[model samples]
Target chain A: MERGTQPVIKARVHVGLKAGVLDPQGKAVEHSLHALGFAGVHGVRTAKSFDLVLDETDPGKARTTVEAMCQQLLANTVIETYRIDIEG
Target chain B: MERGTQPVIKARVHVGLKAGVLDPQGKAVEHSLHALGFAGVHGVRTAKSFDLVLDETDPGKARTTVEAMCQQLLANTVIETYRIDIEG
Candidate 1:
């Protein structure tokens, strides 16, 4: 970590439930919205996005690193799918 | 809801902790990742995204509806900020 070096790489990981997986939280949201009179709303699902700032400089490496992170920690692959977007 | 009518509108609402807000969950996640050998990672923040499927056809109205959802239940406005993305 040197002074005046390349800016930190940013990785956005979007983690979401897989199709057909039951999501009680999402169901609650749909119900709440309907009770609030937003009857047009349906199929509400909850997901998570993580912003990771990493010291990696190469975009390819950064994406690979973050994808590993998602697989290891950020996402539950059995019931979730994740997409990684990287920018320097 | 007519058969084979206009496609459902999709809205993505990203809810995040405001700057200067204390995020224990984010800190814990960062620590966990570092413990697992991702030492290069830093400034890790966690955010929630909501995917809403609506019967509404107009993108503008769809955005408005989801924004209202964020203000009312999707986010804690005092400590959170949200961005809405709408698509059909």
Candidate 2:
């Protein structure tokens, strides 16, 4: 399908930091959860997810396309990894 | 289990803007993707995911606790919704 065309594909991309990386934000959340009396909370790490509607129809191509988008704009490969899920 | 205890609960919380809310960042990413020649992409929305390890063991309690966390810290209820997934 062409841009703005029918049969759009919906995609979700998840990006997360690599293991062993210092996550100050996640640490802060864990601290805050503990401070708020949710003492059972620990090891909290934050990540990102993206929802994209694509004009493409084929799932394979859509996944490939989103992979490039993640590398180019959505994720930092140096310290992060991304997974893409596509749906019709 | 007590805080910092063993056999921790792993919980994932997903937070996303409400359907009608504006997503300038998603739009910007969409625009940039098109500029990068991925013309078939559209309707991009960005969301957040949090991987949390809880000291609690019971799945039910973990979900309840994470729900409270989402309400108190993880999500802005006015403009966003959160979903919690719990695992051992």
Residue B57 CA displacement from its true place in model 2, Å: 2.0
What TM-score does the A-chain of candidate 1 achieve?
Answer: 0.89
| Chain A: TM-score in each model | 0.89, 0.90
> How does model 1 score on DockQ?
0.87
Cα lDDT of model 2 by residue, A1-88, tens digit: 3443467788999999999988899999889888988886778899998999887778999898899988898999999988888876
TM-score of 2: 0.91
Displacement of residue B50 (Cα, Å) in model 2 is 0.8
TM-score of each: 0.90, 0.91
Candidate 1: which stretches are off by over 4 Å? A1-7, B1-7
The two-chain DockQ for each candidate, comma-separated, is 0.87, 0.85
> Candidate 2, residue A11: CA error in Å?
1.1
DockQ, model 2, C-alpha based: 0.85
